[model samples]
Target: MSTAAPKTPKLPVTVDKPTPYNFDLGLLLANDPNPVSVPRTTTASSDPSILESHLANVARDGAQVLINQLLTTCAITSTSSGVLLSLPHAQTPLPREKPVPAPKPETKWSAFAKRRGIKPKTREQRRNLQYDEATGEFGRKWGYQGANKAGQDDAIIEVKFNSKKEAERKEGTTVRGDKRREIREKVKRNERRMRKNQRHSEGRK
Candidate 1:
């Protein structure tokens, strides 16, 4: 009767240490590089398969290493992946400079007329007649005699023959109508001679 109900068994109370919990949480946050996910199997059924799968990764790692080494040698930070690893692009070799154009030659006729203080047309007229070399005087051709204008002074201008035409004339070639007929006659004569020679040779054989 006076005895109190058996003292209820004391339940153990656990007081978690705040310092340890905080320390553990801080350690986890400090060590984590990225959010954790469920770990996946890295090993493959075959060694070759595993190696092949990682080959590209290995190559990328090697490239990164090479880039880092180069950057370190140059005393630069290798943090940025976008930075060029080698020499910066040279100003695309300024398109090979185009050669400058050469100056044009001065016209001889214009220059001569200017020097002589005469108009171009007058100089041209002076050059048309055959001028005497020693006297520097000119005379009209036989067919053109008495045909010059009244104020023209009957002065003969020196005419320079075209080199090609002069050469043709020297070769005894005629350029106009009657000369062409003469050439045709000469060709006919040569053909006749050749036919006669052939006939004579055939008769002898």
Candidate 2:
């Protein structure tokens, strides 16, 4: 018996008409005020091809809407128009500004006067006097009146005023032997008064 040649089955032609993109950006933008609120979930059985196509459609629709708005607002006639438009992929919120530090409280002479119970004298008023207004003490201001040693060689110069003899030896050009003794005595008196004042302030505190 003669057998007919086996016929091959012809494959079904799938004429895929381009899938129409039906996404509307205005509908989504109007319904959802916050883009962050949009759901980004996908079903377990969802086809990747369909999902990809849908996302592409959504992007195209959103881009078209943005282009239309920009063109209308900017009055751009063509791509060659002077307006150069750009859009950022994502926007980051600005960081909260650091709280401005409170201004430091000013130190005023009134506060000093209140603490010492006396009106504070200006530097010019107390220039030539050894006076403590709080203690009502007056004495001679003792110190060497030598020329400033800025121009002298500092390595060779020695300044010592621990005693009358040392003061006379160090700055003999400014103070003589008797003057050096007076200065030494004045310094000791000032130191004793300073210690007493410090103790009184501590007690007050």
Candidate 3:
């Protein structure tokens, strides 16, 4: 048996037509069946006075539009009675008041507490604390008045200072330095993994 190759079909070609163009001067001179001459009367638009009046009206309208925009921008309004009212009054500048000094304990025991470097447990607790000017004292409004004591409630807290050896012993008994270092290393590894993942995601984008 003989093997034969199939023939490929030819594609049709496309041809573009040339554009037509024509010009005539006679079209410009052709007169209309009902021709109207340019106005010459005083009241006509072509009249110098009338033209000037139209221009003035346009200028006035433009000025009124600009004025309205200006009024709107300034937060102002004009009523039907011509009385101007501010839509939203301009904000008044805040007064530059004197700076109030921070509250400090005045009494002897409270002063000792201050010397011992006692600090508030929380920001809210510090603010809510009341000061007695007459007796030179401070008081707490609510909760364990024990810590800040005399400042708000005259309740006092006893805090003991630990020696360096005592602190080290306590740290060893609870959270050891080696354990803390291990935790820190683990956290750093997790952070590195997250950074690597983030970089991969960014590269994909």
- Highest-scoring model, TM-score: 2
Steric overlap count per candidate: 3, 0, 10
Model 2 stretches with alpha carbons more than 4 Å out: 1-117, 127-176
Give each prediction's root-mean-square deviation over alpha carbons: 31.4, 20.6, 32.5
Query: TM-score for each prediction?
Result: 0.19, 0.23, 0.17
Judge candidate 3 at residue 74 and give its lDDT.
44
**Top candidate (lDDT):** 2
lDDT of 1 at 141: 34
Candidate 2 local lDDT, residue 116: 82
Tens-place lDDT digits, model 2, residues 1-205: 9999999886332212234323233332312122322234575136577667666655555555555544444433336566554432333334668976876443443446778898767987766556656558754443343322122334444546586655555543532344455657778998876666665555542
lDDT of 1 by residue, 109-174 (tens): 445667988664566665546655655777663224322322233245343577565465645443
- Which lDDT values do the candidates have, in the order given? 0.45, 0.48, 0.48
For model 3, residues 53-125, the per-residue Cα lDDT tens digits are: 6556544544444444444454445678886534333344346687667664254444556799986468765
Question: lDDT value for candidate 2?
Answer: 0.48
Model 3 spans > 4 angstroms off? 1-46, 75-205
